[model samples]
Target: MRCQTCGDATSPEHHECQRCYTPLGQPAVTPGLPTYRVRGIGLAANVAVGATAVLYLVVALYPLIGMVMARRAMANDDPDLLVSALIISAVVALIMTVAQLTAAVLVIIWTWRARKNTDAFPGAEPAFGPGWAIAGWLVPFANFVVPARVVAGVARDSLWRRATPPLVAVWWCSWLVFSIGERLATRADDRAYEKLAETPFDDAGYQAYVDHYQDALLRNTVPALGCVIAAVTLILLIQRISAAQEARIAHATPQWPTAPIWPAQVWPAAQPASGVQSAPGAQSASGVPGVQPAAAAQPLSEVPGAAPAS
Candidate 1:
């Protein structure tokens, strides 16, 4: 229907006109995702999340470097340096943890909004919502199993419009398995150290346990890194999908003409017949008196011998 206020086309589904932003009583406006507006917001939110993530990484790096240096100092019997490094590591780790968690929260919020915008468009479903939100992150023991699956589900739904993407599902399962294994390994290492504290440790046994625990921790880092890398890759993939979807919508929409083209080039101009002069005064074709020039321009009621104009 055409909007009564602005005469812009609107859809029966919407009560407000998209073009004029007016409340529609009878007329309507065009129906669509309003892609341009939604994408702008989505992109801004995404950028904010990315910036926060970068800040998290910066904070995290200091702790990691400090931890390595502290361990080296301990081995070398540098007591003063070891204590300083430990303090620095604790501070950096605390800051890093807080920043990382905050960034994750922002990411979830941004993705949720983006999903809503996607739903407004055709051929799109909400990929980020409460269901996925709860499943996506830490929640006691539940965190160990749900997050990988949540990531895969969100990706599959948003990018493929499916409940699962084959590759993503398989990789996510592997992530969950490795994550559980990592936690179990960590617990076992702690238990071993507790046993050593109870029983006096021989130099050989203590060194051997230390070596083994260090190896286990090193191995677990691989999977943990894999999960992080995967998350980053998936986010980039989602961004590409957003761009592609926008391009498709732009291509499909009808375009208006830049300027009007008239038919003057196609038809010949009309010419008067010989001796058929155009009227100068009040004269008609059959020699009858024509209406005055003033009357001709006035209402037909005032013009004698002229038909009323509709």
Candidate 2:
């Protein structure tokens, strides 16, 4: 039913809306988990994503700086300064990686809970279930498709409608672009690292390879830009979806069906109910067996005070 106060859909089992806290009625059914909890989780996840994304921007700039500094080094620049900067960048990158992983986990949790609340909503019929939240992110080739689909579904459901989630699409595209760029940069850097270890810096070929390494580092800026966009977009999208769920919850009424009531069986009592008795051959309302109805009767001739039959 639609919430009378806000016109948002909700289950009758809920005493109040998970979003607006608007009272619907007496508990009629078991409602889905609370929306406030999902909101809290989303907020925390956003903080993590936002902070990590900012640091990522720093990480991205370091490579560009490194590439430039390498050129200076080849021109008889201060190698010690370059070495110190790289060491510090590496340490920062390690910290960012750890933080990013933690944030990603929190985001998954938020998605799962959001999907659950949507499913519980009065008119909701989401396309995906909770498991998709994790599976979409972890699957190999399918990861690209599933994660977007799952996120889209949650956002769409939050609106309590079937329209495409435009923000979701935008955020996803940014994320995809960022992922590809980061991968390419990392792969190139790894190759360079292995080659450098094999061939000493003083080798004749090392000078030529340095140019190629600089180019690889320069290439990373594009993806790093994408990462910043994706991070900002992601945080906004999360907040928007949470608000949508709350609005939907506010207008909704409990959709749960009324529980069935069963008749109670009264046990046989020592005395007839209401000090009254049933007439002869009447069926007892209590439905007990082996109990005869109470009534007054004349004594039989077999008894000491018996009255003879007329």
Candidate 3:
């Protein structure tokens, strides 16, 4: 028989799956609860996240490109090309932001559905309810840890009695690192740009502005790299959880027998052999020979010591 949780083949004699340790023939916690399928949404979230990561890499390289542009503008005495480059960078940044938002929405939806599915699995015990899947990401200071817990809970419950994938920790850590680094980088860039705008148009001022911009770009590379690692790990984690849930659903489904194991048969009551017959004097009113019915009792007055009837 195949283990429901992990889809591994196991001996029918065993009480649990050797690969994942899930109990054999375990019944669902709620017998008739519905389960939501997350495989399709997971795939879409993976694609969106992959695109966001690629965009982050491109954005990280923007600083180096900006520095080259600055140098070329100074040499050729032309600012128009530099302005165009800045506009292109802004456009790319906008696109990256949209991709990030799309990815976030898709992932949250998938998480919510996955959490709901745990009710149909026997050993699943989610730490939070389905609502937390979305609310965890919205809470201010708690967002960092709550969202991680929500995902971790889903993974644990989905693969009940099995070790959760390590990718969950890796992805959460990298995501947190990227979030913090990106914020810091954005603040630094804003300060540098404000100072650059205030500086008088002179040789020293231009050089200072270029240096500041290049430094900001270099700092962004850290978050960009983190984003890539988080995205890849998240994709793998989603695949693992989705497959486990699918296997569990298949196992929990009831399989009806196509035919009865022993079909019932009926026979007519037994009869005497072909030539048999009852003798002429054997039959009587009671259907037996040499037997007499009991006589009715005599009246009570007939007894010597009996009192007369009232």
* Root-mean-square deviation per candidate: 13.5, 12.3, 15.5
* Per-residue C-alpha lDDT of model 2 across residues 140-181, encoded as one tens digit per residue: 988888878888877765653467667788889999999998
Residues 269-293, candidate 1: write the lDDT tens digits.
Answer: 3334433333446453334353222
> Poorest 10 consecutive residues of model 2 by lDDT?
290-299
Error of 1 at 221 (Å): 2.7
The TM-score of predicted model 2 comes to 0.65
For candidate 3, the lDDT comes to: 0.76
Between 2 and 3, whose TM-score is larger? 3
Error of 3 at 242 (Å): 1.0
Instruction: For each candidate, give its TM-score against the true structure.
Output: 0.46, 0.65, 0.74
**What order do you get sorting by lDDT, best first?**
3, 2, 1
Give the winner by TM-score.
3
Question: What lDDT score belongs to each candidate, Candidate 1 first?
Answer: 0.49, 0.69, 0.76
Q: What would the per-residue lDDT of candidate 3 be over residues 1-310, giving only the tens digit for each residue?
A: 6765566787878887676556686653347798887889999999999999999888888888888777766666566656766788899989999999999999999989888888666656678888998999998988989888888877887765455557789999999989999989888887777776442355565566578767977889889888988999999888888988877777667888798676444322343343333333443334445322222123446645767767
Those runs of model 1 whose alpha carbons end farther than 4 Å from true positions after fitting are: 1-77, 121-163, 170-220, 248-310
